[model samples]
Target: MGGIVLVNVPTSKPLPIMTDTLQPMLRMLWFLLHGILPLAAEATYLIATYYSDDVCSSSYAYQVHAVDVVNCTSLTCSNGEMSSTSRSGDVESTECSTDYVANMTSTLSDSSYIIVLRFEDNNCSTLYYGYGTTELGECVENKYQGGYSISTLNKDGSADLEHFTDSSCSVAYASETANSSAVATHECSSSKYVWYTGSAQEFASNSNGDAGTSFSSDGDVGTSSLGSSHNMNRGGEYDFPPPSRDSSSSDARALTLVSVVFSCIVFVLVAVIIVLYRRLNRQTPVETRSGLWDDDTITATRIPRTKISIKKLLCRGAFGEVYSGVFNRQQVAVKMLLPATRSNLQHVNEFLTEAKMTAMMDHPHIVYYVGVAWDSLSDLCVVLEFMEGGDLRTLLNKYEAERHPVGIDRQKATIALHICHALTYLHSLSSPVIHRDLKSRNVLLNHSMTAKLTDFGISRERLDRTMTAGVGTSLWMAPEVMLGERYGVKADIFSLGVVLSELDVHTLPYAQVKKQCRETEGPRARLWS
Candidate 1:
């Protein structure tokens, strides 16, 4: 009866029609807000959190439900986010569960709030969740809920069961997932364990031994764990931080103080030593001569000065040419290195090495290295103790020509003894030395026929036993050396034995059927044994 009595309706749409239109429009806006806007908001939050440190720490709290609270015990915070410390005794209401993760994060926003929480169960395990600030709001949740079947688990990959859902619902919350799931897991019978990162102090103690108690105060994020009892002794378990100061400024001060103290002590000690040394030295006899001809410089084994000068050339080798000279106004032999071939590294190194090694070895039995002179632009000159008798090979040749012969047995034994002593000294050096080129020419004799081992032109300290080099004269080379074997000190011993045989027999060990040196040869190059 009321519908029949209704007056003619206006041409405009009914109020219910307008209401329906607004309902659908509102729903579209709701879709944009709850679905699209929420997704866009989450994306922006992540971007903002990544660039900021405080936001990073705050974001981690949303991953778990309420657990972090004041004076936190059993609560965990990572990257700075926290949770409500108090537990919900019995969370039986499903309506409450809808916002369980949300309420937890909202409570952790306070600076004074220290405690955080995590969830774990027999069938399904829940982990820590934290909150981040959104552009639309300050503290916001980043979680959802779903469950995954344990049977569908992958072997090579891993899954994080962040949130659970009713049978009607589908998946877990994105906010609850870790930034990285690739972290290595150690397997137990029914579970895999992951490392729970700890504070900077704890991390430093565990990460490296050198970390020690010395630490920086920058508050960099770090991770370390405690496996033993909570109140256990920290002796070896944890590393405590050292005293803090401005490192750069404090270090400079410490270094300056140490330097000043050291310098003062050194100056006093040196002054005292100098005074004592001068007093002691003055008491001794004053030698009129101070140059190379002094008794200290020239020994009884030294040869007399020769009349010949640098105008006449004595001889020449691949690296150097020898001439006579007056060193410290006393007659001496000078060997001058030739300008090397531009591409010849071996020749250059050999020349420089010989001068350095000879200068270091100051012995009467060894050839005297009087002085060395060189510049970047010029070739090097090495001054030596003049050999009046010349080389052994030359003396032997002269004896053969003349009717009068030298005393062979006595001369040989003297040379042998002197060489053995020199070799022993070189072998016992801190770094064992090797005379790679051992030949008759390198064996020099004074007027008295006492041999002075000379020419370390190609010598090198045996860094280890084996060197990646093929060195030594062909005639005097040992079996191992000739074959380019990884020879040791034994190789030198073998070479020395060959030299002894040569001196006795005046012939090579392999002279009967000498094998021509070839590129490819085995360790058994010579069968002298």
Candidate 2:
């Protein structure tokens, strides 16, 4: 029998055992025939074969026997077992090896496209240990495994590469981007693992067949590559330094300090402003007093001292002088109490009472009380709407100067009617007002010759329709008022009648009474009567 030979065995099953006498004979027969037959190839080799797309399925396939690799145009081998050939045509192969690596690069016969494939096992069953590509710069399969078997597809161009020690690509050990025909290896000092340990190792390449390095865990290394000047140490270890902080960190710290300092300065300025405002408010005294009238009554407005500008003296009386002033840029009549009147508490109270009462009245025929103010010396001042036509007394005097007889009876009737309207409005109030003093002088005329009742100095709120004492011009006073009896709105009616007489007759009330007393030549009892 030809030399007993052991061949094609399966590792998953148990091997058949031979007797001691048979084993010696088989050993002797193998020694005798070893020189005669070609020595069995000790190392595994890669052979490229040809097939159609339907046979390969774009995946690695293997055969138990040697394949006719000469029919294939492209091939790659490890440990110098086989050599590479020029890649051309659609050279596909299903033959593969389980104990060695397979690398193939081929151009399609139908198109100008090229394909690259790498396998880790001879049978090419485990896809996790292989790499394949149809485009350049595109990711290679099974790149998570640290490997260095990267090359150009036809020596087209150079590539840049970086080797990371960790799966996350956070720890880089070597980097380069040069076209290398020979395989390059790298070792990590931290792990003591060689990056090119496996025959199936490969690097990602660009469209120009230039191999490059990837730094991210997802294998997107970007287009740009590192310089080829960087050396990839073979078997030697290298330490990767930690990242260092730049000047930007110092600039950020400086900016933070400036912001804090500026904020502190602003806080100090605000605090100072608040203190000054409080101090100024304290230094300025309050110029107004509240509760001058009943709670339910309309209150008078208080005018600031600076707002009143006395232009000239309009008139003067025993109580005070009236001055023409500009209040809030509008012409106003300001009546200031005399020093003598200010000295008397009764007169001062009466002045304030007049202001309060006038302010409450809203009738058109009643003079509008603008506001009240106080001088620097604390003297009371009352402001009223300026009547351009002056008082009825002045109007009558002008008529007499012009010899116009004060127009027709209609003019007198109108004046009387306006006065009556004002009186009616006062009496109709919830707290009826009593105008104790009613005369031609107290009736003011505006530019339109409209009559407005004024001078509320002696006016009082009379809800009971009675008063204890008589108060008014004696000539206009009624007989019952002169007798000091309790009177009511009837007293104001009597004053209104006297005012109407003055308007119609164009003469003062009881002017004839003074003349009669002066001309009296009879008994004293007649003068009394």
Candidate 3:
């Protein structure tokens, strides 16, 4: 060098003075050649267009490149040769012939997108492999081995990715995220994936491959076809069809109606049974002995023995003694056979006949029969209504003692009318009855002063114009009955006349005859003789 000044270079130090500068220049050159140049050469910007149908109709767009993919429509690729006609008439292409599709950069569009690779032709109707994202690189690796035809991508992406082992993508072995790129090698090895949005994703398997059946997510739960139309929301929910009413529902309604009707019928039947039970209980008869003398004689009504209470003696007779009593809370007169008379069949018969006769008589002027009671260990008593006003004989005696008139014709007529009425009721029967003995002592008066005929001890029912000869009081007896002749109902009228006379006279009939009687008189001369 002619004009340059030279300094001594230290060889051992390897030109330490220029090492920093040269090293930097070489490092920058190497970085440019190794990093930037290769990046520029390998980088490819690709726009992928997808179609819902075949032949690239109804297409939407997605993008892909060498470094990463935005949206991948197909698995197959060439060197910038794979192209599809987009909606905007823009022809976008990618080179994936020598590389796996997932190795390329992908960008999904605002609209959903799916990748469907076909084996027969460019149309997606033939054998195919479906995928949701390019992360599944296995789908591209097996592309040639499986004979792919055409590849198409859907504009609407799926919410979930279902992977199937068959070409139809029906039999699902795995479920994955829609944006996942990891390979499903276990249950989904060599499987296809189908992207669904608003439809339910169900898998069906066959020996050939798994097939996909699509149903609206809102549809009834059962096997359904993917071809059914449904609306998909942004959240990937599907609005499915409503379910139909089947025979099972109808049968349930019918059963409910029948049950209600049966319940109503049962309720009505139970109510009716209850009402009948109450009615029968009310009508049930009290248990008591039927007849005092004869078991075959049944009374219309019977009073239990517990219902009678002896109060006081009311009167006495040869056949029985009458006592005031209480029966069923009402004052009553009870006539019981005397001990002395019990052994006499005639007196017992007379007492029983009185009860039987009064039991059937319903006249207002007749004493009412109130059934019978057991007065003592050996005595059976006949019960009758109590006469608070006593008998006509007592009333007449009270008038005589007070120096009042023995009888007013008006009072006598009223008493006579009542007695007549009682006799009429007894005689008007199909067979007339004759009261052999009638007198003031045998007539009773109620609290209201209404006269009632009583003392039916010797009464007889006359079938024809005849009567028993030996039954009558000597004073009240009809002339024919005193002669021991057969009599008729008129005998009772003759006895009634004597009762009226006694009421007027205020004394017993034939008082002189009774006073003059002596033991020496012959029995017939003292009476009918």
Candidate 4:
């Protein structure tokens, strides 16, 4: 009866709709319009305007200030009595009859005007205009000397200032009352505008461009004069107003910044994943072929790291080719089996049998089967093991060439000792075993001349004192077996004796045995008596 084998074939699944090409196309579009280039341009524009000498240059740097106002109902206190505290830990106050709510200053220049207003965290909404004055000559020498200052709000209520200019501004103020605070009915005037000549001395000395009043008869503020403001309902107590939006380019700027940050995070994550994958594969078990083609393609059935990577073929045989390689950080030889010879059942059986049988044994003289991996895709793999020296046949030929050759006396004794140990173990099996084709080529060696018997494909097991396999190399056959006679363990002893006789004459026992067996007569010689 034949042994059973189970084959697992993978099922076919449908491929995804989004192919490889489409992914790159989408990425390219994202880079072109929304990536680093756009972000860089936006940053450059913002920096140039922010560093410009005319507007509030101090606005570019954020700072904190707190103002404590006691018993104040309106922001119209002229006595300047409110206490002011700054992030620098400086506090200032003055004696006055009335207290004002708050005052924080971002000085544009010595004489330039500042417009202070609070912005919502959304960056697109404003709560309400708290207090601001562009009043020209009334500019305080030290902006916080009056002791009234605006307290720094949290991220939800931070303030930013924008310069009202001839080229840029039209001022519109909106107010809301919250927390039952009473509105002051005093007729408040709008802030003034003036041209500051970049110096305290110049600003103080010159009276030319300072405005006498808030706006001369409410004339359009700038040359274009198309500025507009709108209010939206928010919680009924507070009104939300649209921020001074930076004209259509703000979205482009913000989107570009986000994309660049996202891309960089993805790139770093991919690099880490690749490193971990390499480490995992190196530590995985070895069960594959281990050879490399001349074209740099590796053909390894097993994974083995050697001192040096192999790059050439050494020899070929019925099983496959053997290649030079390294193993365990030492110079060793690797045998890579060819694909299964499915046309010949015996060859396939030999290959399968070698892997199964040797995988169980672990001895220095016996060839080691490291492990095995089956590749369902290619249906082939290279088995790996250690090889110290070449086969015994190659070593003997080399010894013959050296002239200080291996003598028959030592050769026979050594071969007998090693073969005896291997066969004795195989024969003493619960069912006695036979090595159907034993030859010099099948005997391998190590650097210390240790011998190992291998190649047991055609071997059979005996049951109940009876064996019925007609197999074996003819030259090593016993005389009785050659005459169509059934034989048992005695046949193996007979073959060993023939091997022993060859050591005496330094000649092969069955050199003419095949020809003699065809003689149309009884057996001619007692070659294995």
Candidate 5:
């Protein structure tokens, strides 16, 4: 008698092996695959196919399967998909089932393929499975580790994610809505959660728009049922999870870092511009010889040169010092070039130009230009009506400090109207004037709260559509001016709107826009907007 001696072999493996009752059968299959049997053929390519009821489309039951007879294919289901695929190298027919939402057929050869990815999305709504046959023996990748998709927002804390041994996903097959925020892992070979099966129609209707809404390009899940415009697969959904932070977190962190860096760089640039402007204003004696005070337009407003008894010093600028003084036995604010910048032609020219323009304007809402007086270039000064209430920004601060809550009132409206009156007169001229630097800082008020528009050095006479751009405070600048587009009188109108807002809120325009930008783009977005 010819008796074959047989050894009883036990399957031993590592801790995290996908090994169980099927291990013996897998071993036999592995042996059959390693040229052990003449009946076994060498598998050249890999393919996966699945049929789903709710293939991430509609709430109806329909069959959608993707077959790749040409190359690698990945099939994804809206609900949990768990159907073992036939290992044959050819496309095999699968009986359409209404009870199961996931039915996958795969031609998986022994781990000798390229791009073997089988992982679920971070949300676990879609599962990506299959191996690539584009280039065999080039690379080996296995993506399936743990977890499943199709996570609905569980307002409650519990998540009952279980599969059924039966075909249906109703109460009889252990179907649940998963009332937790987190996605639960799917157990492909566990006793409690036997196999993944759920109602696509029920899940889609109950997903609350939080459906695991991704599918494979190689195949579709609920496309036939979900005949919507969202049928096309989005870009970059074919890759695996990054080794570190996920895409959203990584992108947020990158954006925040960029915003911070850009903000710092902008702050530095603005500081440098301020420094350069001051330095440029303090010019050398060579540039001061440009006959700044000799200009006929400026000397036309000259008064008898007299000594000014400086009462007290007000604010100081790069070019001059402002002082509350008496001019011709009347209260007035005297603007005198700083002793250091007296010889600076740029400073003298700017002071004279402003004086000339102010003297020409005659309106109660405009700052009164007293007269131009000077003994020599060193003593050159411009006298104007002294505003007891100081600048509008300062007055507003004082009101805020006194806990004076500002509301819509006639007083506020009158002040804004006064500024508007001044603007209307300037624009009504033959060649309309554009107050490019209009802001609360440039608007002065007297004791009775009567406002006046001042500081017209940057103002321009617009003869045509042509005009300079980006000449106003960024916070108060019009949209067109802020973008460096050619502006007209409409730019001043925009600044008036901002001043109105300041009166209403008693805050700087930058303060309000910065807060709003924080909720949207960065604070610098408005300046660039």
Candidate 6:
């Protein structure tokens, strides 16, 4: 499976019944009126407006098209399209759908507005936009003529910039230019026209110079007018209200907002109730995906930090620290991210990936993972079965120091075989996992000396060439991995042989291998000499 993907496709709208020559006919009519009327000497002109989206025509510096998933295959997968969520991005569109609720704030990486189309635990679509962390001042948008400045030469009437004055095309705004042939350029408030375009774009100007349908006086002006109140129902598109039905449309929009907000609150309450019910009933979260839990799966196994009791620190690592701890009255190892590392998003993502990988293992030869616990992101930690026998490296050093026979024995062979079992399970998965950093230090031994593999910090699935970033201890890393080339299951096998060599020599690799050869072959030996 290619995980899950959602594709956004544009919607289609047909032009209201009109012949192809109608546009040219309207142009000729305007020229004839300009030629005949003396009103052109001192006139008011409403710059012709078109219903099309040009990037700069709106105040938004960045646009996010949120792919709306009306019907999901599952929480992880969907197929649909996103309407642009700019405050005015959809005002001119022919259709709108508000089936899903959206929430936004200007607090992301770019310091811009972020609107998310959320489903289950997944944020299906993310949009970052608006004026770079700066809050828009009231009436400030008028400076940009509706916070949307147009400099485009695609002048099929680029803006819905309505200018009326004493002219033949008498409208509410005015421009200095009298002749229809003169370039008419004017800037107006963002509230100009809620028009439609493309093949669906059509207009019949009456005596009043009203090109399209007249908008209601009681319509949302722009981003500033909507404020923060309607975020719950600020969905795909806004329907333009009819002139006379202004009161009714406002009421309808208000009702829609109210109802959608209520639904969202109810959904949140239901989700809370479900979580409480599960916690109250002590329902154990079952493992899924055969040892490769994702974000959702990891969330299922989440426990509050209050349930964990730290005993003592076991070891320190690059980005995290492991502590011997107690959870649900069982001895466990709690691996927590360092306080300094928690603020880095990349580190946090890796920690979560490690949590998911740890939670997915279900084999006896692999370190048993307990639930993860956190009160907040700052206290994030994963619980695993604690090993009383420490790591293999310490055990080997002990035997070598005591002057005991330090070669491959029954116990060492058994340890090697147990590691093989773990590796076999990992490599045989549906999406084969590679233990990229396999070494003696990562192999844990319990009180009974039963070995299980641990430390999945850099392990990865062999789904593609992108999994080539894993480099463990340089001495133990396979040549292909060290060379940064694409490698597979055999890369781990190479590391396994290195481990077996450790069992035979009870020493670290490379340096000691030649030393042993020198002792065995004598000073006169060609290679060792």
RMSD of each: 38.5, 52.0, 57.8, 40.5, 32.6, 28.1
| Model 6 Cα lDDT, one tens digit per residue, 281-349 | 778645445232246778799887998998766665545778888998999999987543565567777
lDDT of 5 at 79: 34
Ten contiguous residues with the weakest lDDT in model 5: 105-114
Candidate 1 residue-wise lDDT at 277: 60
lDDT of 3 by residue, 1-529 (tens): 2532546665765643245444554454445435433322322222333322233322222322221222223432222212111223323333332222332212232222333322232221222322332222122211212211112222222233333323323222334333212111111213332232211232122112434443333322122333224433332333322121245554655565556545654654564455455555765534565354553332444467778888766555434677888987889998887543454566655666677777877889998887865534346678898999998877876776687676547877888899999999888988777777777878999988899988887787886668657676666888888888878888888888778777777666665353355234542122211
Alpha-carbon TM-score of each model against the true structure: 0.37, 0.42, 0.41, 0.35, 0.43, 0.43
CA error at residue 414 for candidate 5, angstroms: 0.8
By TM-score, is 1 or 5 better? 5
| Prediction 1 global C-alpha lDDT | 0.44
Candidate 6 Cα deviation (angstroms), residue 231: 61
Quote model 2's TM-score: 0.42
List lDDT for all candidates, in order: 0.44, 0.51, 0.50, 0.39, 0.51, 0.51
Residue-wise C-alpha lDDT for candidate 2, range 189-239, written one tens digit per residue: 121211111111222222234435422222322222221423332321112
Q: Candidate 1 regions off by >4 Å?
A: 1-309, 339-349, 399-408, 507-529
Give the C-alpha lDDT of model 4.
0.39
lDDT of 5 by residue, 37-132 (tens): 331221122222222233432222122222212122233442322212111221222332221222221111111111222234443222233222
Cα error of candidate 2 at position 23, Å: 99
Candidate 4 residues lying further than 4 Å off, grouped into runs, are 1-311, 327-333, 336-349, 362-364, 377-385, 398-408, 480-485, 512-529
